[model samples]
Target chain A: MELFTYENIIGIAAGICTSIAMLPQLIKVIKTKETADLSVTMIGVLIVGVSLWVYYGFLQNEVPIILSNSFSVVVNLTLLICWFLFRKKS
Target chain B: MELFTYENIIGIAAGICTSIAMLPQLIKVIKTKETADLSVTMIGVLIVGVSLWVYYGFLQNEVPIILSNSFSVVVNLTLLICWFLFRKKS
Candidate 1:
């Protein structure tokens, strides 16, 4: 059996950790229909930052970076949409 | 004035777009103290994905990727913390 390199493992591990970390907040937002505690500026900065990651991935032709960030962009966008709907209702 | 290459511009654009997208949701969450609408699985996945992006950036020796994702990890983690506090309250 060929062992995965340390770098690959680390990358995969980090991915898992970050992904898990996002779970609670996403869950809370969906269920409560409230995103008031979070800051707009921070989210905005993050969105731009992730977009840059996607571009960087494309430039480097890295599959993991592209796939990961693309998915993240979609998820974050969905959250934004939810926030809008919540606002419209309230 | 030196014009950035198309690739650089694209990278910057994506970063900005993604970062902007995160703003509303974060704001809503903070203001309302409601994150129930969000899914744990989804946020978890995102956190993991971003972590992997960071690792990928490091592996590639890319400055933009590393910096952007690092910041994202921090932000996402903060949201998670807020979610925990919110959950504990309700």
Candidate 2:
């Protein structure tokens, strides 16, 4: 199997994008200490969804998927936690 | 390949969860007309990332991935549009 193919590159790029996408939001939430516009359901569902992806990756032994989605889960967890802390305050 | 295997079910569940995860946020934005706490960069990055995943799914002939990510892209786009519509009003 050829690694680094066009499709693989796109997949990896997508993974990287999603994996790090929430970090900025987390930072924004923390910096602003705001969560009024954020939706708790969205973040909660995403955590469950991404965790399932992580488990599926584990079943398939796909390291990239596991690692990237795991990263996403961590960022998402922090985002949710920050939302909880700041939700009532805002 | 066996259809509806445990791993396949997990994958599908994950897809469904992620595909619909942003809906609540969109609804909140529309109903509340607020976007102050939302991060434009996160939504933009997610749109790009999910769109890439759609393309990758197409290239790989994965119908489920393509469909789910397509739905997610639409939701994310609407969320972004809603943000634009309401950000200034907030």
Put down candidate 1 lDDT per residue, A3-90, tens digits, no spaces: 2566556655665565455556667778988877555556556666666767776676655556656766666676777777776554
Which lDDT tens digits does candidate 2 get at residues A11-88? Answer: 888888876676776777889999886778888898999999889777865554577788989888988888878887
Model 1: per-residue Cα lDDT over B1-90, one tens digit each:
233666556665665565555556666778888877555556666677677767776775655556656766776776777687786554
* Top TM-score prediction, candidate number: 2
Q: How well is each residue in B7-32 modelled by candidate 2, as lDDT tens digits?
A: 77887898888867767767777888
Worst 10 residues of 2 chain A by lDDT: A59-68
TM per candidate, chain B: 0.79, 0.82
- Give lDDT: candidate 1, residue B86: 84
CA lDDT of A1 in candidate 1?
Answer: 20
Q: Which candidate number has the best DockQ?
A: 2
In candidate 2, which residue ranges exceed 4 Å CA deviation? A1-3, A32-42, A61-64, A80-90, B1-3, B84-90
